[model samples]
Structures are given as structure tokens and as C-alpha cells.
Target: MDAAEALTLLMSPQGRVDPYPTYERLREHGPVVQALPGLYVVTGYAEADELLRDPRLGVLDDALRDQVWPNWRESPAVSSIARSMLRTNPPDHSRMRRLAAGAFSPRRIAGMRDVVRAQAEELLDGMRDRAGDGAPVDVLADFAYPLPVGVICALLGVPATDRPLFRRWAGDLTGVLEPEITVEELAVADAGAAELRAYFAELVAARRRTPADDLTTALVQVHDTDGERLTGDELLANLVVLLVAGFETTTNLLGNGLVVLLRHPGAAAALRADPGLAPAYVEELLRYDSPVQLTTRTTTAPVRCGGLDLPAGSTALLLLGAANRDPRRFPDPQRFDPTRDQAHPLSFGAGPHYCLGAGLARLEAQLAFPLLLRRLPELALAGTPRHRTRLTLRGYQTLPVTLGTPAVADRGTPAGAHPGTP
Candidate 1:
């Protein structure tokens, strides 16, 4: 299949289910190929890396939206995304990113390491109990979903009780990120975005009234040297971005990582034995099956890339998943090797728009994976995992797994303790 055919297939639901083959077909055409009028697709690692960092290629924001689709802002879902730092260019992006950076500092992320491990252990214990009943546990619900949500909530000073609500809203809102969402989905996304905005507005106000040692409080009080800071709308939009972006991608990462680990028993065993290998293991997991499949950027000016000189305002869809698996970049790209040297996948992207929460996500996964494997040594796939029907953010909707057997007796015995004695 040519690039056009491949892109067509990729936009289809079936193609989203498994787009690797389509990516391979597109890559055969060239690193970068125009799939449609004024739209290019980058399937090679080098091209994607370069384009992601290119100043000429920028996020398609409201200004660009006006140029492309006259009625773009008519959709609330689209407008909400447009306001986010995720889709903004330099000045606005830089300001928003700088304000949010304080909360996600290395110090803060390191402080949360213990918190993540604790959450992981508690969830694993619950999974253990569920497995004791001889019923399969949905890992997505029991473990992957809750762990990241809890961590992000704590970071954002969101009450733990509101987790279920966040999960529901996040689910609806994330559909907006997909390329081919239905009208019904768009309606739901609109409602979700409005509700989320209102929720954060209240939260931000409360933070101002009584500041706490959390990310939200920091954001509310943060100001630049010249007393510049996030305006009300900027604050609301970015807060929504933080809350949703915080857990959504990490949830997918954990889910995808577990699936990969379960499929590769040797890797799982290795991780279980030496938890210290988690950092490297997590990197490999990310590269092997990235949580995010693709991201887009538009040309700000006429620029040459991949031996092609394109006109201004051209859209380039960077296929991150394909780039991660590009043979030229990664030797034996398909293989899952935890000890792979210098594995720097574009899963979190690159340059200015690189995921701000990348470090936190890495910390959570690094801690959670080790804790999980150690606690649930017998974990195994109970049934076929169901991947969420999201092309952009790829992860399991329901990952059914059996925790094998309870590592501890039900009679209030600690794990690894002698049941009869203790």
C-alpha cells in the first residue's frame, strides 16, 4: 500500500486496532510522504525527530484553526483543546509550560516516588485478594486505572473521593484527541470539557483562598518576574489540561507496559528479580508499545524536510509509534529488550512541546512496575485484553489478568510470613 492508502487505512477503526502494518507500508514509501493535499505523514524516526524540534513546524492553534476550518471554534471540544498548552505555539506555550514546571520539578517528582509505590502496593494487594476468589481481575480497573489517577489527584490537590468522576470525564474528554471521533462522542466530549472547566475553576478558587502544598496551589499562586501569570481562562484551560493529561497517558502506559510484560515472561521474571532494572525496563516498554501513537504539527513557513520542500501551513502527522519501531533507529526494533542501550523513543515527543509530565510518568511507571511484579509474581493474562478504541492514545480498555494465587494467607498473615505461626 502507498502512503495515501496506508493513511486511509489508519483513519479507519480497524486500522487503529493495529496500525503497525499500515505504518510499515507507509514507511516503505519514504520517511515523509504527503498522504493528502497539504498534509504530510512522517513515519521515520529521523524525520519525526527533526520535525518535532523544527521551529518552522508548530502546533495548529486557534489562528491556524481559523485558516483551515472557518467553523472550527463552533465545537466546544475543539475549542477547549485549542486553548491548551498542548496545541499552542511559542510565547503562550512557553508561559504555560514555565508556570506548570514548578509543580513537576525533579524534587517534587522524587518526593512522590514513595507515594506511587504505596499506591501500587495497595492496589496489588487488592488484586491478590481478588485472585484468591479464583476470579479473573480486570487489571485496568483494579490496578492500572486507579494508581495513576490517585497519584495525579494527590499531585493536583484533588480530593481522592472525586477520582470516579475524573475517570468518567477524562474518558469522554480524551475522545476529542482522536482523529475520527463521532458526533455523539463530540457532544459527550463537550459536556466533559465544560464540567471539567467548572470543576477546576472551583478548585483554583479554593487554592487561592487556602493555599496547599500541591501543584494546583502552586499554579494558582505562580507569577512571573513582571507579575505576569495565567489569566482566568488560561488557568481553567491549563488546569483541565493538567488533570486530564496527568493521568490519561500514564494510565495507558501502565496498561500497555503490563500487557507487554505478561507477553514476555523472561522480561517479567527479570524485573521481578531485580526491581532496580525498572528504569531501563520502563524505557523499553515505552518504546515497544508507546501509549501515544501520533501527534500533529503544522508548518509556520515554507521549509524543506525529507527531501521535500513544502509550502506554509502544511500539516505533518508525526507517527510516533512507527518511529519507535523504525529499523534504522532501533536495532531489532520489534524485540522487547529491557537492557537495550540508549533507548530514547519519541513516545513523550521531543523539543519544546515534549510532554511536561514525562518525568512524573516515568517515576510512576518505574516504581509501579517493580512493585507489581514483586507483589504479584504469578500474574498472568486471564483473557484477551481489550484495547480502547482510541487511535491517538493507545491502551487497554480492559486487561483481564489472574494474579495466580494470594501470596499471603487470608488469616491476617503478612505476605511471605509463615501462615501457621503468624
Candidate 2:
């Protein structure tokens, strides 16, 4: 397939199902290609790395959107998120990120290890109860989904009762980030964003009235020596973004990690036997099949990228999934090896906007995987796994498995199973 054709297919359903081959084709032409007028696609490892850290490139902020897609803010979901650090440029992004970073201190992250272990054990217990008598249970529905959700909610001080509601809102709201979205999807996303805005407004107000020992309360009080900090709107928008971002990526990681472990019995055995091996295993999973496939950036000025001197006003689609597997950067990319001393994956991205929850996401997976293997020896795929339709934010929609260790499961051969490598 040619570069343009491969790029087109990457956004198609078939491509979303498995884009690695398409990425190979796209990378063949070069690291970067002008997919269309005003749009460039970057698939090469070196080029993607250069562009991510390039100060000339930035997210599609409000001013940039107005100049390009003027009606972009017509959708409430779009407008609301655009106000947050995720979509804003330097000054605003730096200010908000500083406040949020304080809440995500190294000490705080280190302390979450115990919390993650507890949550993972609790979810596994629930999964075992549901899968009693050898009945099948969806890892996505029972374990993978709730584990990260519960962790993020606990950090944010969100009530347990309100935890279930986030799944629907996050699903609806996150779709707006995709390049392709129908009117129906956009409507749902708008409603979700509105609901989130209202909910956080009250929650933040509540925190002000009665402070708590949680991330939200920490953010509410965090400030610089000059007393500069997140404004009310920034606080609301960021809180909503944090909840959605925190869980979605980790959920995908857990679901994807589980399948790979099931497929590669050697790796699974190693991880199960040596708990210390989890850090490498989880990092390798991020490279092999990244939860976040792509991210976009627009040029603040004429910038040299992908062996081309593109003009200002150009937008580049950084194919991070492809870059992670680049042959030059990683030899034998397709084969998943936890022991391969390899470069870091662009899965959490790079530069100033690197994922804020990246540490926590990694922590969640590293703790959850070994427990999953040990706690449920019989856990094996019960049926063909299904992935979510959305391509931009990829993950399992459902992963059915039986708790009664299917015959020969230890050898990576289980009932109703497919190849473990995604």
C-alpha cells in the first residue's frame, strides 16, 4: 500500500482492528509524508521523536482552531476540553500543568503502590466471585474496567456510588478526540461534557467548603510563591480530563497486557515466577500495542520535519504506535519480548505534554498483571476478544475468559482462543 492509501486505511475500521502492517507500509515511504494538503503524517521513529520535542509544534489550541476549523468549538465537548491544558499552548498549559503536577508528586505516586495492589486484589476477588462454577467472565467488564476506574476515583475523592457513572461519560466524551465522528457521537460527547462540567463544578465547590486529603483538594490549594495557580475554569476542565485520561489508557494496557501474557506462555511464566519482572513486561506491552495510537500537532512556525521543510499552518499526525515499533529504533519489533533492553515507547508521548498520569498508569498495570496470573490460575480466554470501535483511543470493548483454567492453558493454548499477540 502507498503512503496515502495506508494513511486512509489507518482511519478505517479494518485498520483500527490492526494498524501495524499499515504502519509498516507508511513507514516504507519515509518517516513523514504529506497525506493531504495542510496535513502531514509522521510514521518514522526518528522523525516522530524530533517532532514531539520540537517547540515549533503544539496542540490545536483555541486560536489555531479558529484559524483552521472555525466551527470547531460548535460542539460543547470540543470547547470544554479546549479550555483545559490538554489543548492549550505553552503559557496556559504550563500554569495548569504546574498546579496539577504538585498533586501528582513523586511521594504521592510512590504511595499509590499499596493502593493499586489493594484495588487490583479487590477487583480480582469480584471477578472470581462472578466467574464461580467455571462460568465465563469479561475481564474488561469485571476486572480491567473497574480497577483503573476505582483507582482514579479514589485519587480524585469521587464517591464510590458515582464511580459507575464515569464509564458512560468517559466513553461519550473521549470520542470527540477522534478524527472521524458522526453527529450522533458528537451529540453524545457534548452531553457527556456538559454533565461532567456540572458534576465537577459542585465537586470542586464541595472541596473548597470541606477540604480532603485527595488530588482534587491538593489541586485546589496548590500555588506558586506568587500565588498564581489554576483558575476556576482551568480546575474544572482539568479535573474532568484527569478522570477520563487516567483510566482509559490503563484499561487498554491491562486488557492488552492480559491477552499477550495469555498468548506467550514463556513470558507469562517468567512474570508470574518473578514479580520483579513486571516493570519491563508492562513497558514492553506499551511498545508492542500502545493504547494511544496517534496524536496531532500544528506548526507554530515553519518547521523542518520528516525530511521535509514544511510551511507554517501545517498539521502533523504523529503515528506513535508505528514509531514504537520502528525497525531502526527497535529490532524485531513485532515479537513481544519483556527482556529486550529497548528504547522507551512513545505511548505516553514525549516533550512538555507527556502524559501526566503516565506513572500512575504504569503503576496500575505493573501491580495488576502478576496478581491476575497468580490469583486465577484457570483464567483463560473463553471466547474471541472484541476491541472498541474507536481508533484514536484503542482498547478492549470486551474480553471474555473462564476462571477454571481451560485445558492446556499453561501452554498458551486455551478454549475459544486466538493468537495472543495484538
Candidate 3:
């Protein structure tokens, strides 16, 4: 199939289940292929990896913004979004990333190691308390989703009591984040955005009145600085992006990782036997099937990829899912081998805009996986798992699992103690 044909499949509901084959076809055709007028998709590991680090490719483009948010062409709020880190280029992107990066540095995230593990255990404990001898538990609902949500809540200083509300908002935002959706879904997304903005506005007010020692508190302090901080709208938009992106991606990582282990009983047994294997398993899971399937970028100048000349101002959607599986980069691309010697895939992205929350994300996965498996050794799929209707973020929507009745260890140490202990 041609690039256009593959893109059509991507936009269709059927493609949501499995975009890998289509991505492979696109890669075979060429590294760069136009999806539509002014829209191109790149599926090669080398090309996508290079473009992510290129100085010429700009995220903030008037032409692309016109295409993406046509309704907000004349609105200042859209302009604020245009100025945010995810949408900007060069110095602005650098600045925004730097500010967010400080709070998410390896050192800072290291401090949260215990917090993440504790949150995971707490969430799993809740599920166990509810589950009978062989009761079915949704891994997504009972464990994956809530674990990361709690960690992010603690990270951003959001009240844990408001988790249910945040969960709803995250769902609505994820729907719109998908490249293809019906007009009604788009309207729902707009409404969801409005609701999020309103909620953040109030939350910011509360934080301003009484500052706490949390990331959100620090962000509000940034605003108080002499025009060096993100604006109110920028804060809300980025916060929404951070919360949604943070929870959605990690939740999928945990879910997809377990799915991989379950499918390969050998690796599952190995992990259960040796908790230390969890980190390596996490890396393998990212390589085998990443949560972030693709991302979009645009060229500021004409560039040749796969013998094709893509003109300036054209869209480029990098298929991270395909590139991670590229035969050139990864031998035996289709297999889920936890012992593969390849470097971890570009799941957290690369270059100037590489994910800021990567450390925290990895910590969450490393800690959550083994603890989960150890706690529920008899966990198994209860039904045919169904994935969320999202192409960009790939994960199960409902992963029904029959978990073993977990017996708690007497006087368990907190989750963070393991990493810190000598």
C-alpha cells in the first residue's frame, strides 16, 4: 500500500487495533511519504530520529496551526497554545523544556521512587481488598490507571480527592489527541478543554493564595517572576498536557508490559522469580510495542529522505512504532524478547523535545511491574482484552484479569526504600 492508503488506514477505526503492518508498508515505500497535501509521514528509525534532533524542523508553524485548530485562528488562547513548549521551536521550546526539566531531573525523580512504588502497592492493595478468591480485576482500572494518576497528582500538587475528576478530563483529552475522530468527538474534546481550563484556573487561584512545595506551586512562583514564566493559559494547557500525557503513557506502559509477559510465560516466570528483571522487561516492552505509536513534526526547509524530496512547511508524522520495529535497527523486529541487547526504543522520544518526565516514567514502570507481579502471581486474562480507541497512544482499555488472593508481607517497607537502601 502507498503512504496515502496507509494513512487512510491509520485514520480509520480498524487501524486502531494494529497499525504496525500499515507502518511497515509505508516504510517499504520510502522513509518520507506524503499522507495528504502538505502532510508527510516518516517511518524510518534513522530519519525520524534525525528529524527529532534537527534544528531546521519547527513545531510552531502558522500554516500547520491553521490546519490543526482552524476554529481558533483568530483567538488569542490559540496563540498562547502556539507559544507553549510542545508547539514552539528553538529558544522558546528550549526555555519551556528547561523550566519543566528541572522538576523532572534524574535527581528530582529519584526522590519520588518510593512515592511511585508506594502508590503502586496502595492501588494494588485496594484491588486485592475488593477481589474475592478468584474475582476478575481490570488491570487498567484496578491498577495501571490509578497508580500513575496518583503519582502525577502528588507530583503536581493536585488533591488526591480530585482524582476521579482528573480521570474524566484525561479521557476526554485523549479522545481529541487522536488524529482521527468524528465531529461529535471533536466537539466533546472542545468542551473537555473548556472544563479543564476552568478547573485549572480555580486550582491556580488556590495555589496562589497558599503556596505548597509541589511542582504546581513552583510553576505559580514562576508566574510571579518578572515575565519569565508561562502565562495563565499556558500553565493550564501545559498542565493538562502534562497530567494527561504523564498518566496515559505510563498507564499503557504498565498494561502493555504485563500483556507482553503474560504472552511469554517464560519471561513472566523469570520476572516473578527475580524482581530485578523488571527494568529489563520494561525496556523490552517499550521496544516490542511502545505506548506512543507516532508523533508529528514539520520541515522548515526541503529535505530528502528515502530518495524523496519533502518540501518545506510539509507535515511529517514519525511512526515511532514502526521505527522501533525497523529490521535495520532491530533484528527479529516482531518478537517480544526481554533479553534483546538493543538500546531501549524511542518511546520517550529524542532530542530537544524528548519527554521531560522520562525519569519519573521509568521509575514508575520499574517499580510498579515487579511489585504487581509479585503481589498477584496468579494474574491471568479474564476476557479478550480491548484497546482504547486511540492510534497515537496504544494501550488496553479494559484488561480483565483473574488475580490470586494476595497475602501481604508482614510490615512491608515503603516502595522507595529499595532504591535508596545500600
Candidate 4:
């Protein structure tokens, strides 16, 4: 198969559970391999990092306008949603990012330690109660999926009652980011986007009538003397961006992290014994099995990456998963090592478009994982987990698990689980 066709198969749903081998092959061929016509794939850590920061590489820049077929151009709904930082370049991207940064500031996240812990504990409590004598429980459904969504909802001032709809919208809409999408899937994503927008539109109206001390309210009212206020479309777009980024990414973080732990029982036991290691464990989880596996950038100007000349108007797909496992940058890269002293993983991305919700995401994962383990020390996979049918997102659709005996509260005592706690 040609390079492009190979990548197509690798990104197909049939290969969703294991795309690493294909990534390795591509990396071996060249860190910067041309995947298809007018597109380059960067699999090296150094190169991906540089391109991410390069001014010539952008999202939805003029380059797209030039190359895109008229009939295949982004729909109005898609364009509307893409106006956020994820799909825009600096200046406008920087401005929109800064507006939301304050709410996700490290200080704010630090202050939320108690809140994160409380929510995690509450969620775990419910999970433990429901898991009677060894019943097969879906960890993704019971734990990972709910934590980040709950946190984002609380932060966005989204009413608790309305979260179910947002959850469905996020699940369907975020699938568009996958590398290879079928026409039917694309249509579903488009419909989901429209529904999400309509839902948020009503939400915005409600919030405008009765302002709450939350990110949504802050975004609407935040202004500079120079008259910098998010426009109506911008507000809706950003809210959608925040919702997807804030929840879905971290949902995968938890799901993927659990799978990593399952693969390493010794490390799991170690973490269970020393809860203080939670932060490092969480960081390592991001590196070991990143939630986001790839990112797209189109060249606005000809540039050289990995000693290859990439022409203007070309697309560069950064293989973050492969980059994270590059042996040159990470020794024994395939090994899952929580004790490794890597500075930071590309899991949250880098440069101008680095994930804005990084702090909140880390906080939620750090708190949630330990609480989960502490609550059920004997947790093990109930059956083979089915990963989501998504290429961009490295996460599970269901994580069936069985819990061990539960311990006491606060004393590191494992929660008591009924016989066969699944």
C-alpha cells in the first residue's frame, strides 16, 4: 500500500484499538513523512514541537481558503464552531485564549483542590454503592466519563439538569476530530453540532437574563476599555470549544489512565499505597497513553521540518502519540513508567494553542484516580474493554471492571465491596 492508503487503514475503526504499529512504521520511514497529496505527517517530538509554534503553521488560515474545493468547503455551522482557538491562529487565538485563561489559571485550579476531591469522592461513593458483589461495572460509564463533564458543567455554570444533553452532544460532535470519518459519521457530527449550538444558544439567553458567577457569565461580561468583548458567535463558539475541550479530553485521560494501570498491577499497588504519588502518576498517565493522539496544522508558508521542505498550503499532521514514544527523546519509550522524570508530555499539546483547560484537567484526574483506587483496591478489568471508534481520541467506550473489598474513609482503609464487586 502507498503511504496514504496505509494511514487510511491505520486510522480506520478496525485499527482503532491499535494504531501504534502503523505510527511506528511511519516514524521509521521518516519523522516527517508525506501521508498524502498536499499533506505531511510529523512524528518526531522536536519537529512537532517546533511546527506547533511556527507562525507559518495555522488552523483555518488563508491557506485553507486557497486549497479547499468550493463544494467541500466547511459548512457555516462548522466554520462558526471553528472560530475558537483550536481552529484559529495567533492574535485572535491569543486574545480568545487569554479571556478564558483567567478562569483556568493555576491559582484557580489550586483553589479547587477541595472541590475536585469532594466531587471525586462523591462520584466514587455512588459507584461503590452501586457495585454489589462482583457485578460487572463499566468504569468509563461509572467514573471516567462523569468526572470531567461534572467539573466542566460546574465551571461553565451549565445547569446540572441540562448536562445529559450536553454529554450526548459532546460525544457525537467531538467524533469529527477523528482522522478518518465516514460520510454517515460526518453527517451525525454535523447534526450534533447544530443541536449543540441551539442548546447553547438558549443557555446563553438564560444566562444573560440571570448572570451567574461562572465562566459563561464572565466571558459575556469580560471587556477591555478598548472594547474587546466576545461577539455573539464568538461566545457560542468558545463555549462549545470549552465544553468539548474541558470534558471530552479529560474523560479519555481517566479511561486511558485506568487501562495503563491495569496493564501494570505492580505500579497500581504502588500507587494505591502512596497516594502522594498521584500527581506524578497522573502526568505519567498522560504521557503513557495520551488522550489526544494527533493534531492538524496547515502550512501558510513553505517551511522545513525534520530536514524536509514542506511547501506552502500543505497540511501537517502531528503524531503526538508517536512523538511521545520516540526512543530518541524517551528511553525505553514503550514502557509505562510513572517514575520517569520527563518535564511535560505533549498530551496537552504545546505553544499558542496549548490546552487551556490543562490545569482543570490535571486537577480532576489527579483527584479522581487516587480516589478511585482508594475506594476499590481490588479493581480489575471485568472483560476486554472496547475502545471508542475514534482515531484522534485514544480512549475506551466501555471499561468493564470488578471491584474488590471497599476500605474505610480517610484512613487509607479500602472500602468494603460486596462479594464480587463488578
Give TM per candidate. 0.93, 0.92, 0.93, 0.93
Q: Which whole-number lDDT from 0 to 100 does residue 103 have in model 3?
A: 77
Model 1: per-residue Cα lDDT over 41-91, one tens digit each: 999999999999999989888777897678767776677778778889989
- lDDT, candidate 2, 42-151, per-residue tens: 88888988888999999998787897678976776898789788998798898888777855677787877777777777777777777767788889878888989998
* Cα displacement (Å) at residue 284, model 3: 1.3
Query: Against the unseen true structure, what C-alpha lDDT does each candidate score?
Result: 0.84, 0.83, 0.76, 0.79
Instruction: After superposing candidate 3 on the true structure, give the runs of residues whose Cα lies further than 4 Å from its correct spot.
Output: 60-63, 67-69, 73-83, 407-422
Candidate 1: residue 278 Cα off by (Å): 1.0
Off by over 4 Å in 2: 221-228, 405-422
**Superposition TM-score, candidate 2 onto the true structure:** 0.92
Q: Tell me the deviation in Å of residue 176 in model 4.
A: 1.8
Candidate 3 overall Cα lDDT vs. reference? 0.76
